[model samples]
Target: METIQREMTVFARRARASAGRMHPELSLVSYTLLGHLEERGGCRATDLAAHYALDKSTVSRQVAALERTGLIERLLDPEDHRVQVLQLTDAGRQLLLQVTDSRRAAFKERLADWPEEDLRRFADYLTRYNGWTPPAAG
Candidate 1:
């Protein structure tokens, strides 16, 4: 377990570093938040914080940065004029698509020589590991 933990930590660090290089202005966290917004159409800032298990302030900062970059915007919820939701702008969608393609291409190049079976097993293992749920908090 310790070995797995250590290796996973290293992998995560490297992935983040690679992502940073792919887009200097976008942190992995921000990219992830953007992806979530893209996927969900629109959501509240509080929703992002809760979904990512992040502090509201931290999410707020990221949202603010994204807003400044013109990647995201706040819109009034049609059903509830009092509420606001975040959504990606056209520019944000385009940027995310480009970055995603670049990342996928990089992954393909890095693993080009690996056999399909190995790749399948690796992906399955990652999914299994990620799917594990911790015991409920007391």
Candidate 2:
């Protein structure tokens, strides 16, 4: 268990570091938020916060920074004109794609030597790990 925990921490640290190398302006959090927006076809700030279990203020700050960088914009929701949802700008989408491609290439290179069975097992383990939920607070 200790080994698993330590390795998971290492994995997270490496992911954060690699994110910086991929794009100076896009931190891991920023990249993740942008990816979520793209995947969800845009969503409210509160939705983002809830999905990530992040503080609303934190999400607000990140959103502001992305807007300042012209990477994201707010659009009125079609279903609710009074409400606004966050969406990536064209620049954001392009940058996201570039970083994604770079990350994918890097992964391919890094795992090129791994056996196919090992890769499949590793992938399944990751999926199972991510699917785990903590017990409710006492």
**Residue 83 C-alpha lDDT in model 1:** 95
Scored against the true structure, residue 37 in model 1 reaches a CA lDDT of 98
Residue 10, model 1: lDDT of 100
Q: Give the per-residue lDDT of model 1 (tens digit) for 4-109.
A: 8899899999889988988999999999999999999989999999988899999999999999999999999999999999999999999999899988999999
lDDT tens digits by residue: candidate 2, 24-73: 88999999999999999899999999999899999999999999999999
In lDDT terms, how accurate is model 2?
A: 0.96
The collision pairs in model 2 are none
TM-scores, each model vs. reference: 0.94, 0.95
Model 1: how far is 22 from its true place, Å?
A: 0.6
Model 2, residue 134: what's the lDDT? 80
Worst 10 residues of 1 by lDDT: 127-136
